[model samples]
Target: MSREQVVELIPALRAFARILCPQPENADDLVQETLIKAIANLNQYTEGTRLKSWLFTIMRNTFNTRYRKREREVIGLPPDSTNTLVTQPDQEWSARAKEVYSALMRLPDQYREILVLIVIQGESYEDAAVICDCAVGTVKSRLNRARQRLREELGEAVED
Candidate 1:
């Protein structure tokens, strides 16, 4: 793929990164890092495949690596200190959105990732499977479970 093509995907990459990282600055950093990695390893990318999926794979891997490293290096912050980072929602919609986002954040990584990839990002099952390195059936199963879990979290009635 051409560099310009990759550049065009920055907005999409930023959106995905925001979902993965939450904090805007961190999301921007993740997108930048993804672009750098994609550029550096451009030769490894196969032609005639979805560049978005390939870049997503790289971003997912990068985020996972950073998460693992952070887990190991995590330091306990003063309990009250966290409150400083949270901003109170002003509007009703904002509050509801924050609630939904919080529920999403509470989901397990795999479930959350699947939901974001399929439900939020509008990725096809086949594309999501490729990005996630899983079978299509696995993607469907995870999506089902993720929806069920989200409904449960949101206090919606779930059908069997």
Candidate 2:
């Protein structure tokens, strides 16, 4: 991918990072790490492929790696340090949006990733499958399960 093309995807990368990392600073750090890995491994990138999906795959892998590391490191630690104070939203829509986001965050990583890739980022099933390194049927199944879990988390009745 050209330098310009990679630069243009920074915003999208940051948005995805934010979803993966709830803290804004941590999200920015993840984006920076993703960029570093992508640039360092530029030779591995195939020409004529979707650069966005490639970058996303890198970001996802990076996040997963870091998450697993943190899980191991946090054994028997106090939970207070992980909690952040959130301010209440002023507007009704903003409150609703925050509620939805909270529910989304409670989902397992695979489910959340699929939802963000397909529903939020608007990636097609094929592209999402490529980014997620899974088959198209797997992606669709994950998306369906993610939606159902999200709705359940939000106290909504599941339709069939």
Candidate 3:
């Protein structure tokens, strides 16, 4: 991929990386690593395949690798529960966004990743499914389940 193409995709990569990693520095590193990877593996990418999809796939794999590393160092963190919020907003928005964020963080990695790709990152379901390596129908079903579980966790407060 040309430098220009990589530059154009940086913002999207940033968005995805930011969601995957909490710190700005960490997110930047993740994006940087992803860029290096995408470039290095450029020849392996199929011409007709989506570049953005490939980029996201790299980001996801990188995030999982990092998470595993972190997990080995410490194990006290609660397993990401579908009911925990992943939304964030220490100020403004309300505690709800943070609550939502926590719930999102708690969700199963598969469901949470799809939610971010489709809902937070605004990628198409097809793109999300492609990046997620699942069928479109599976993506839809997971999204439905994620939303339902999140709503159930928030209960009536989410409706207000």
Residue 88 lDDT in candidate 2? 21
60-135 per-residue lDDT for model 2 (tens digits): 8998888545532442245565534321222456767988877887788788989999876889899999888899
**Predictions in order: lDDT:** 0.80, 0.82, 0.75
| Candidate 1, superposed: residue stretches over 4 Å from native | 71-78, 83-93
Model 3 TM-score on a 0 to 1 scale: 0.76
Model number with the top TM-score: 1
- List model 3 lDDT by residue over 93-128, tens digit each: 567787886677677767777888887677899989
Query: How should the candidates be ordered by TM-score, best one leading?
Result: 1, 2, 3
Q: Of the pair 1 and 2, which is ahead by lDDT?
A: 2
lDDT of 1 by residue, 1-160 (tens): 9999999989889889877775555678899999999999999999999898899999999988884344323213354665324222224567678778778877887888899888767889999998888999999999999889988999899888
Would you give me the overall lDDT of model 2?
0.82
Clashes of 1: 0
Best by lDDT: 2
Give candidate 3's whole-model lDDT: 0.75
Error of 1 at 106 (Å): 1.0
RMSD of each: 2.9, 3.2, 5.1
- Worst lDDT run of 10 residues, candidate 2, spans 82-91
Compare candidates 1 and 2 on TM-score and give the better one. 1
